[model samples]
Target: MFAVTFFDGEGWREGVVEADDDGQMLLREVALPADLPRLDGVIVGGFTDHHVHLELVDVDLLADSVLGRVVDLGGNVTVLGDLSARFVSLRSLNDRSLSEERSDETKRPRVARTSTVIEFAGAFLTPPGGYPSDRDWAPSGSFREIASTDDAAAAVAEMADAGATRIKVASNSDAGPVFDDDLLRTIIELAAARDLPVVVHAQGPGEAQRAARLGAAALAHAPFSERLSDEEIAVQAASVRWISTLAIHDDPERATAIDNVRRFHAAGGTVLYGTDMGNGPTPVDLHPGEVAALREAGIDGLALVRALAPADPRDPASVLLFLRGDADPLRARRLTPADLKV
Candidate 1:
């Protein structure tokens, strides 16, 4: 058994773990034996950056970074589909290594790292001439415009067909036209039918509240344009998850975004770590700036670690362990991709 320290959603605990043949840990609640060989570091499951754009970043770099998985909130379906396929193929190829390749029995296997898992929301489902449609940064086939109820249904259907793990909708009123209440409702319902959660990029006044009222599963960015009322924040905290893209904004908006996330988290809301990478200039790997912003927003230590864990973090054994030698595991900034094995 190897000595380890892991985050159990609420806090970190010292424990002993056993690694399977594939170098994955079998975490359990057991007493640590002093005589057993112990590794000199903390161990954490795989980390995921909840929001990203594959089109803008060199995705290959993420495989070696601290992030084991990334979710592309909006991108060209065809491009993202092909990219996801490529990662799957890489994992398949890597899994075929000979068992005898491990020359040392005492030391744990140093398994070859596989490509980062890419979970994408096929395209930005938006109204005609919506936010990203007018942005030059958005690639072709990245945003699908929905003009009617029929359009919303078809757009959701197309995304589902493309193997989108989630449906991304945009309501950037500052950029251009946004979906009306009826149309937005239609899209949410359609996504629910396909068992896909809907994440919204809600910009402009009241857009964030509208998304929560209409049952969006998450907000791509913390509400930056407006300050939500206590009542509004409370209601949203009960049902919606907010992705922290706080560091991406400039002053004033940056302060407002951090305040919103602070309150939301205080109200028992689920917060996911996301940088909105590729929106402008951001790191392709684990972002220290984003981590700083989250720390300022009252999410730090084990709470911050929980945000970076896999989306479905129920099974601890399924994720990779991050080993940080002689560093404060609570300080996420000190942890990097080099600390991860396999």
Candidate 2:
């Protein structure tokens, strides 16, 4: 596209950004290039679905969605690794093999080395019988049962060896047994040693607070089971990012999460736009409910837009969603990957 429009945290403006056919971005103040034939439609930056489950959802549907990037939070590490292998084109195959051989300690995002980058947490690390372990959706062998701290290092290593860039810890106390503080600390320390971030599925009372104080990179979902206290909210704001899966909730819990996010954002915590896509009725990409839910949690306009584009601003703009009119994320309905111009 010759011209691009983006949100400036105040309002939408034209010509604030430009992109080339190679999908790289240029954030220049100059007007749209008059040389190239003007392409119609308003262009925004690339989109990311901060949380999804490819094992449960359709991968082809995701490829056809608005996500320029995706983060698969929990699954079988080998399964995700096999999925990543499918992304290598003939041109990048040699480079991919070379990088894999060279970077054992380096945990690059797993899904795409070339286009539509996908970062993954590999598998679920939960205490024996915790939350998803009993759920039918969590396939057998995908979750590591941390019965003791003795198994922590090995479990973390298994995921790391399977090409996990980040680790997912399940702290769902409401469902079943959970790792004690010591075990939690052990997992966190091991992940830190590997230079991988830890993403926590913090649920139940005080669980989110614990994950926050312990230095997890982000919570897989905004805590919904209970309202967070001022101290809990502050610690989370100070140390963790909350991926906004607010649309995937029912009342009392949904309201609870919204208030927590509102306070957390007020306390300077970062919120990312994500939908637990496979958990229920969430759309493949840019789910209107997710955008609307984020807006309800007080992340309106530019702040809202920023949540959608969570990656580094200087990152190449390979894929982008084109708006037909005013840069209203909520108003843009039926937007699929087909609507994205790369």
Candidate 3:
């Protein structure tokens, strides 16, 4: 008999379940009510970090940490795909400047790296000279500047043909011009036709509103430019799922993050846990700072756990994550790298 904790959609129940020859027990048996409520350890499904930059952190170290599933929001897909054991989802950015004069390289979106399976976002379609184009850390083939509906549709096709599972667009204009309403709507409609979700990196005043108005499937980062009004929050609540990268905001901009998250949470927006790990000096695992900050923003033990844990959108019965020993949710919230023995 193997000690296992079970997770059904609600919470974890403890029990002992028989293991197979390979030491793996059927997830369904473990989650059964009769099998639960008697186990010595806690078994939960693996945590899924919806947004992370694997290029910035040590993959080995991250595997040992809390994250079990990681989605690379941006970076070289080949590098992220090579890591062992951990499940990885990659999205390649399309910002390479192919010479129009050079026929061979012109139409082909640069496939700088290759991966086993990548949910590639071919390019970040932004207005001319947008957000990431000028950033020092921005990778070479990461930002696509689109000027019209035709350009937008063609860019989407290029990424799809390049094997992109999804599309990424920059609706943010803090650095420069943003995608106008017409172009934004057209991109959303075209992507929908292909059954692909458009991930938008939206920031500041009009960006979040525009993204929501255009029906973006997800927002790459929590809107930090301003506090979203009830009307704006309602719009987002209708569709968008905010990927929380609160730790990316610096000391000066932390207030903006807190305020925005508060409003989003108040309006019942679905918040998915993410860390822009590669953006700066963040820990390899679930950093205590992120947890503390989230708690301050009104997310506590249960809700926090749900956000961090991998969620199966379709099936309720799936692999569960287990945290062994007597770990209080509040104490877990306060855990630092030193406290994690595993």
Best by lDDT: 1
Question: Whole-model lDDT for model 3 versus the true structure?
Answer: 0.61
How do all models score by TM-score?
A: 0.87, 0.80, 0.74
Per-residue lDDT value at 245 in model 2 = 95
Candidate 1 vs 2: which has more TM-score: 1
Residue 123 of candidate 3: its Cα lDDT?
A: 56
Tens digit of per-residue lDDT, candidate 1, span 1-342: 666666665666777666456553356657888776655576665678899999998888776676668999999998999999998887766655523346566754455455578899988998778888988898889999888988888888888998899999999998898989988988999999999999999999999999999999999999999989889899999999999999899989999999999999999999999999998889887788898899899998668878886322225323454545543333332222223333
Clashes per candidate, residues 3 or more apart or on different chains: 0, 1, 15
lDDT by residue (tens digit), candidate 3, 13-115 = 5444443332223333433444333444455544666676665566556534545455666554334334322333221221122111243433422221111
What are the per-residue Cα lDDT tens digits for candidate 2 across 1-342? 344554443355665344333223444435666664433455554577889888887776655455667889988888888777664342166345434543233543222223456678887999877878899898656788888767889989988888888999999988888888888988999999999999999988889988977878999999999888888788888889999899999898899989999999889999998998799866777789888788888998678877887333233324445556556765443223223345
Candidate 3 wrongly placed segments (more than 4 Å): 2-4, 9-19, 30-37, 76-122, 311-320, 324-342
Task: Identify the leading candidate in terms of TM-score.
Answer: 1
Candidate 3, 292: how far from true, in Å?
1.8
Please give the range of 10 consecutive residues that has the lowest summed lDDT in model 1. 329-338
Q: Cα deviation in Å at residue 59, candidate 2? A: 0.8
